[model samples]
Target: MKIEVITLNAADTLQAQEFGADRVELVSAMNEGGLTPSYGTLKNVLQSVTIPVQVMVRPHSFGFVYDEKDWNTIKEDISIIQELGGNRIVFGAVTKDGEIDEQLLEKVIHHAPNIDISFHRAFDQVKSQTNAYKVLTKYKDNVKRILTSGGKDRADQAMDELRSLVQLSHELDGPSILVGSGVSPDNLATLHEHIGASEYHIGSGVRVNKDFNQLLDKSKINQARDILK
Candidate 1:
């Protein structure tokens, strides 16, 4: 199994790599559900971490619906990431009616042709995950994966939905599904056993005191790593 840790800064990035994270999702403003990190921070993290770094390209945090300026900002961020040698990018967009914004997604995918794109948790906001999965399948070649909690607040509460999504992904041979939101070491093994998902994304779960403001807890990360083993 692969563990992707969300890091808010350079220090967190280094700690995540040292504590055995397979990959790092670089972002800022966790309070706002993560915005794009500063260029300086992105450069520092890219230089400091040897492990794969997936930069979050979100322009704002209120919702997934983006405007023209937001899309422009996202494109700029993607260009910055590409120039900084970051290969993986995480982002998503949806319509007001709760569906994938195909037009915007195509623009995003076109802008970052050299990078692997992971549709972030915005998948959970869609009206129907089943329908969302079908929509994402159309862009399977450009979208590498989808990070979701099965359209629920917590993945554990929606295991059946997650399992179904996993099965669907396998059947289509499309994008991989990365389970996140409320995943912790305590239930990591259970989720793995039940959902059979190989990729897990953690943000606050591995933090000190489980607080995003604090540094990542090495012990917590080790515990999760041990369980994965």
Candidate 2:
């Protein structure tokens, strides 16, 4: 399994890399659930850490539903990331009725043919994960990962659904289930035993006092790394 840490700046990426993070998701405006980091920050972070950095491509925190202007902005950000030698991104879009926006997803994949996109937590808003999983697997080549909370507020609290999703992925050679939210070192073993996912995304879990605004706690990160191993 891989441990993906959420990082706010170049300094955080360095800390994450030194502390056994297999990967890091770079973003800004974390208080609003993450938005795109500035170009300078992205460039500095990519240079600061050797671990794979997955940049968040979200244009806004208002919702997953997007318009033409939003689409253009997302495409623009992707171009910049690719130019900076970044070939990994985290993004997702949904329809008004909460279905995966296949149109937008397709456009992004085409826009960044060389990039591997991890469909972000916007997937949690879908009406049915089973149906959404089916939609995602269609573009499994580009949508290489799904960062979800098992369609709930917390992945640990949605074991039954997560287990089923994990099984479904195995059956279809589907994207890796990058489980996120409510994941802490205290409960990682239990979540792994129950859900058996291959990747874990952590935010506010390995931070000092479990606070997102606080610096990442080295002890907590090492503890989680040990457990994953």
Candidate 3:
């Protein structure tokens, strides 16, 4: 199994790497549900580790629905990150009516043609997950993965839906889904068994005791890694 860690800064990236995480989902203001990291933060994180970094392109935490200017800013951010050698881009977009905004998504995905992309949990906002999967499946080639909590607070609570999504996605050649939200060592095995997922994402559970301003906790990372093993 592969483990991915959600990180808010360069320090977290370094720590995640040392902890045996395969990738780091880079973001800022994680306390507010994450936003795009500053250019300097992106640059610093790129220099800090060899593990893949998936930067969040969210402008704020309140909602996934975005306006014209917000869309433009997202495109701009993608270009800047690509120029600075960013590994991957993580983001989400929804309409005011709670549907996937395919029109805007096509543009943003086009802007970052060379970078790997993952649709964030905004997938949860779609009113109907079955239809939502179809909408997202349309971009399977452009998107590398989808980060979701199974439309609930944590993986365990939504395992049935997650498993079904995983099954349905594979049936349609849709983007791979990386279970997230409340994933941790304690429930990793159960989740893996339920979803048959090779990849997973974690944030709060791992960072619960972390000091983002300093280096990551190597010991805690080892513990998490050992559990995954």
Candidate 4:
């Protein structure tokens, strides 16, 4: 299994590396779930970490439904990311009625043809998980993974749905399901056993004080890494 740690700054990025993280998802405004890191922050983080860093390209904290201006900002961010040697991007968009925004998604993919893309937790808001999976599968070549909690607040709480998604992922040769949200050292073993997902994402679960504002806890990250291993 690959351990993808979410880092808010250069310090957290270094901590992720020291603690044996396989990948780092870089973002700012983590309190708002995660907004795009500033260009300077992105540059410093890219220079600081050797591990693959997937930059979050979210324009706002609210919802995934974006307008023309929002899409333009996302494109600009992608350009900056690519220029700075960041080859992986995490983003997602959905229609008002709760479906994958295919038109916008394709445009983003077109903006960065060479980089790997992971649709973020916006997948959790879709009205039908299976239907959403089908829509995402159509762009499997471009979207390598989807970070989701199975349309629920936490992965463990949606084990059955996750299992079904994992099964479908294999069947369709679709995007791999990277489970996140509330994954922790306590339930890591159980989630691994039940979901059998190959990739996992952790944020507050790896913090020292269990607080998003605090820096990542190396002990907590190492503990989770050990469990996953």
Instruction: Output the number of the lDDT-best candidate.
Output: 2
By TM-score, the best candidate is 2
TM-scores, all models, native as reference: 0.97, 0.98, 0.92, 0.97
**Which parts of model 3 are misplaced by more than 4 Å?**
208-215, 227-229
Residue range 1-229, candidate 4, lDDT tens digits? 8989898888889988988899989999987889999998999999888999999999998799999999999999999998888889999999999999999999988887777998999999999989999999999888999999999999989999998999999999999999999998879899989999999998888887778788788888788888878
Clashing pairs in 1: none
Query: What's model 4's lDDT at 5?
Result: 88
Model 1 — TM-score against the truth?
0.97
Residue pairs with clashing backbones, model 4: none
Across 188-225, the per-residue lDDT of candidate 1 in tens digits comes to 99998899887999988998888998889999999999
Off by over 4 Å in 2: none
* Candidate 1, poorest ten consecutive residues by summed lDDT: 108-117
Off by over 4 Å in 1: none
Model 2, 46-95: lDDT tens digits are 77777899999999999999999999999999999988878899999999
Between candidates 2 and 3, name the one with more favorable lDDT.
2
Cα shift from native, residue 207, model 1 (Å): 1.4
TM-score-wise, the better of 2 and 3 is: 2
